[model samples]
Target: MATDRLGLYVHIPYCVRKCNYCDFCSLPNGGAQVPEAYVDRIIDEILSYSGRVSTPVDTVYFGGGTPSLLSSTQMARIVYTIRKSLNISPHSEWTLEVNPGTLTKEKVDAFFNLGFNRVSLGLQSIHENEMKTLGRIHTFDEFISSYNMLRDAGFGNISVDLMYGIPHQTLASFKKTLDTVISLSPEHISVYGLIVEEGTPFYQWRESLPLPTLDEECDMYELAGRQLAVAGYEHYEISNYARDSYRSRHNSLYWRFGEYIGVGAAAHSFFAGQRYFNTDNVDDYIASSGISVTQTPESECDLEYEYAMLGLRLKEGISLSDYESLFGHSFIDGKEQIISRLEEAGLLTLDGDRLALTEHGFYLSNSILVEIL
Candidate 1:
């Protein structure tokens, strides 16, 4: 079943407004309306891979630009097209990424009515000044209102996104944001550290921004682990925390090196041992029917390294048996010395058949992964 299952990701490339720190492929809304024909193009792309998908899709994620920007009717049309064109499992985990101020009661109801089971809300920060600096259109109040609206619309699985290391974000302020989010008891929480990516407004002003000190940023990450643990949320991945069994299954597919199809402008796909992404240009994507992107074939070595890198991001890490069975090579080969060294430093844990990172190791994951890879 694991080998035959499929995951679907649909990218909605339009946003109500773009954030200052974002470098993701997205366009801000002007006076122009969202292209209704874009859904048709996405459907066309899905059917292009018709021969490869032998089993029903297990998950569907409507990632954004702001999927919430679509009207209920528009979203429903796309959802309907996906099911009509593909073999979707009856128990599929369908999720949409929504921004706070963009959600409407009608859209929320449409999502629930259409069988979308999860909503990942973008509530970057609750602090007013921080929100403005980040160029987010929604306020803390708006986030709360949108959240309540989702609940009323019958979304039991919701994830709240929070940011740390924000400009002028003090420890006290970050703690308060976390506390507020925890009080609401959303099914999942995604805590991320701020980064000034190139081509963004924050990058140009990075030198002058009053961002937290390196020490302070580290402190915030550590604090998040401690606080979330006390609140009964599992630190399942480096940037993700979930309560009970609410871990993101679609995302888990990615970490497990499972195959998936991504459709839309700037979307990426990994299937049948190849990886490719659609063109970043919206016009090109639409005109070309989403086939203008380059596809790269992966070598056996590249896949092995990818599995190690991605698997190490999880709390359970890599299963030695799975690695050997899949690749016909032991993951411990030649890397035992480095792994043993990391274990001695308390950055990694060798628990019988799995090689996982300790909590401290997760914080230094980038460096550790580089060393191993």
Candidate 2:
């Protein structure tokens, strides 16, 4: 049986520059600010969790504002500490996120030598103008260079991120982006539709710009999915497409409602039937003597809703059997009427024991899920 193991996430909150559409917890580059002290604090936090839980870690992910910005030595030190502090399995998937400009051959080699088996590169688009519009500092040439360097470094498992529906992006431009991405043939590709979050530069500029309509965005999504499928990528999630054997193990943990522990500023964790987040302030996080009390765990109702939302995002949807196993009741007992209604509308399909969304339903998944849940 596959054990109900926990994954580990470490957030690196420093970035050389903040993107126009980003609202993630990150700080822009100031002066010479090294993450050494912050790494020490996180090591302490990990040690605090020792002996409190017995589950072995199967995955470790280093996500960030730009984790590649850290010196290779710094990264190695953090990885060493994590290995020492946790009961991590030898074959666990260890992933690190890298921005295009910061990935160098030396850095890539160092990360590989330190046992990072996966590297997720941020290559938002291949168009220089589009990159500029998104406030990205790297150009297409720089991204390609970084990619080649990683390949030269002998890293086999690589993932790349792309964005669609940006300002001035048309079907043709989006298709070109997809073509560029497919040509690279990454093991995994995460395509996201740009959402204008409040307080971000894109959101503030929304009034002056003509954003893509919802229908146009949906059309773009469908086109991308079709193209990716033709290239032998599985549309495993709403926004993720991966080649066989390349699906992100760490992200799958989130979609499957598995437990994970997150470290660093603004990191979130779900463990022991509880969900919580760390402080977003880097200075405060590093200054704390112990696990900061700023974390807030979720209520039981919130967890239920999260399970429904996350599971619905996957192509497999949620298993009725798994729902009963977790909640101690048949999923259909309470939602039979709703399921039947949705089935009538051709939004959901029930093939004996399995339940999933139909092709049309996936595009309107949110509305369908709200009705069912």
Model 1 score (lDDT): 0.89
Clashing pairs in 1: none
lDDT of 1 by residue, 310-365 (tens): 99999999999999999997888898899999999999999999999999999889
Clash pairs for candidate 2:
none
TM-score of each: 0.96, 0.94
Residues 234-325, candidate 2: write the lDDT tens digits: 99988899999889999999998988999999999888776678888889889886666554656656766787789878888888788767
- After superposition, the stretches of candidate 2 with alpha carbons farther than 4 Å from their true spots are 1-3, 30-33, 294-297
Which residue runs does candidate 1 get wrong by more than 4 Å? 50-52, 290-292
**Leading candidate by TM-score:** 1
For every candidate, C-alpha RMSD to the true structure in Å: 1.6, 2.0
